[model samples]
Target: MTDKMLKFVKIGQQTPPKRDVGDRKDDFNEIYDDFIKQKAEEQSSRCSQCGVPFCQVHCPLSNNIPDWLKLTAEGRLKEAYELSQSTNNMPEVCGRICPQDRLCEGNCVIEQSGHGTVTIGSMEKYITDNAWEKGWVKPIEVKFEKDQSVGVIGAGPAGLAAAEQLRKNGYKITVYDRYDRAGGLLIYGIPNFKLEKYVVERRTKLLKDGGIEFVHNFEVGKDATLDQLRKKT
Candidate 1:
């Protein structure tokens, strides 16, 4: 297992290509081009497969970074995607927004020893993107319908993720948001350079497709009392 990894001595660090500064200033788009199959595999191969993976521990989400990296290196992209998605409700979103320089990649063992980190974030995105393209991503399927219904308070990542998990366990979930659109911060706050609105929209659509109901422009306090809402739920 370790043999397939630890190619850092043979391969230098490489990340997804970024648009030039001049082009970047012209419009709002993702700054970095995605890593192609070969480049992603090559970068993933740089992982040391250390006895202890600091990358996972340092991740706020505690993603199985090294395991997915090894799976990517071995060309097992589907397995890599499954492992990557196992720990994250929104792996693609985290892969884009999480500051890897301050977390997973920052704590990589090989990176501390002078070999550049394995480009973990880029690889994470690539795995999931590949999964989507291959139709490996599936709809939410509840085990059994629950007698109880739950109301979520926001439409941001936290609320969306919560709704997904709750729905999977057969709870009827209704997300209420203040804005006209769902995705509270994602739709209105973050700039497109770092995170695109369409990416967030695609996810919102998926949640709707998966049966998570959303009530936008809904002010809980003004529209209905917390106690009233609680009773309805």
Candidate 2:
């Protein structure tokens, strides 16, 4: 199995199949189809297992790409998802929007050798999407709840990521967003085709279910001043 796994020198690279441009432009749905079990394995098998992964070095968050790819190739998807999520606050979001042609996949060692780059972004999306479908994506599990609470002013990526990290550390988190939904740009700015609304909703729901409070349609200055919140907290 190990012998077969390191064959990027021989095998060609392949990415996920994308929707037709004309068809995809009509609506805000995912442009690419989800990787099938077999397809994901096949694609993962193209990894060169390089000694120094240029992909990891080039990644914004320096994710453990080769390890997670190996896990995915071996059909250990849940573990792969966890590994993928460790560094990335939003693997699914990054997978959807990240320009692979410019980042990790583009700098892949195998790609330099003309075998083409591993489809890192697509595989990431596959892992997270599979995790969600299988109910493997769970909320932050706090070890001990803290008495003190935090107020996150925005529901953007930074705020959400902060809230998740703090919640995991047992801090009571309260996210206040002006919109009705929790995700800031994720809910309104990004089109549905690239990232479906339900996917974002699922993560938000997990945070809510995990006891992180969300106050929607609440602006800091409009609903309550900074002074008022400071006193309340």
Candidate 3:
């Protein structure tokens, strides 16, 4: 443990090297390359392992930064990915689009100390991407089936998170969205560079495969009202 903590002190910070802005601007491919094994270890070793991790504090989802960072440094990537995903409903998605400069990376203790911040966002992306590549991501496991059914109004992030949690508890779910595609902002609103369409499609497919029904091109106000939906449910 002492050696682990000391590694942070010795290893200076580094981030995933980004492609030239001009080269990246023309296409929708991911902006930064995935961190190779050595690069990931180097980057993870930069975390200060602070007594108070401000990175976690400032994160919208409050991810367990230090634990995952330590795990990453130790090359226990699968455990790191699991810990990262515990707080975040979609670690892979969040790792891609979240504005780290304004959130977690911005508040990193090492960054505040004038050492460069640990590349938390890139490491997160690496962890989840690796997990997916290794087929470690599995479908949600429902313990028992329930009688009550739920109708989710949107296919956006919040709606999807709620649907996943409720479905895990065995609540029947039907998602209604105005757009033809299920993901509200994820499919249409976000630019391809930040998120590939297939990534969003995969999640939508997962929810569908999990047995959540989706009603597309179905506007609530036009097709039905609050009272109507309530009565239907």
Candidate 4:
């Protein structure tokens, strides 16, 4: 495992290929292409695997970065994806949207050491996308359903995360959103160049498939009061 790491001394940082500007002008789809398997492995192998992993520390979610990167270098992608998702509910979403330069990748130890920082965001994206392609990303399986139900207002990022966490703990979850769709800002605010609508749609679908319910196009203040929502829940 040690032999697989510390390759940043020899390897330069790299990200996924970008679509041709001429072709991109016509579509609202994502600009960066997915990293091929070989590239993902090679880039992942560049991790310094330092005693103190500043990348994980600086990440808002504090994900287990080095372990997953090591797993990717070792060709254990399922394990890598598992570790990545353990701390982050939506690795793929964060990979695409998170300003990693201001956070995780920015605080990388090797970047300060003069070797370019590891392509952490791209590696995270690759791991999750591969997991989705291989069917490793699955709906949560609750062993027991609790009697209590939770009402999450607004299907924005925080609300959706709260709903998923509650559902994981066996509570019945019902997400109420003003829009016709589940993802509030992800669907209406962000552009496809940064985050495709399908990604948010698929994640919301997974929550529904896991037995969570969604009440769309229902504004709380207009439709009902807080007390009424509580009673409904």
Q: Candidate 1 vs candidate 2: which has greater lDDT?
A: 1
Query: In model 2, where do residues sit more than 4 Å from their true spots?
Result: none
List the global CA lDDT of all models. 0.88, 0.87, 0.85, 0.92
lDDT by residue (31-64, candidate 1, tens digit) is: 9999999889889989988778999999988899
Q: Give lDDT for model 1.
A: 0.88
Per-residue lDDT, model 1, residue 120, is 86
lDDT of candidate model 2 versus the reference: 0.87
- Across residues 58-94, which tens digit of lDDT does each residue of candidate 2 receive? 9888999998999988989999999999998789888
For model 3, what is the alpha-carbon lDDT of residue 135?
80
Per model, how many backbone clashes are there?
0, 2, 0, 0
Report the lDDT tens digits of candidate 3 across residue range 18-109.
Answer: 88999998898878778998788777877778888899999988899988988988999999989998888788898899999899999887
Off by over 4 Å in 1: none
Candidate 3 has its poorest 10 consecutive residues by lDDT at 1-10
Residue 8's lDDT in candidate 1:
97
Better of 3 and 4 by TM-score: 4
RMSD of 2: 1.6
Per-residue lDDT of candidate 4, residues 1-233 (tens digit): 57988889778888899999999999999999999998898998999897889999999899999999999998999999999999999999999999999988998888888888898998998999999999999998889999999999999999999999999999999899999998888999999999999899999999999999999989988998898988874
**TM-scores for all predictions:** 0.97, 0.93, 0.94, 0.98
- Which window of 10 residues has the lowest lDDT sum in candidate 4? 1-10
lDDT (C-alpha) at residue 45 in model 1: 88
* Native-structure RMSD, model 1: 1.1
TM-score of 1: 0.97
Worst 10 residues of 2 by lDDT: 3-12
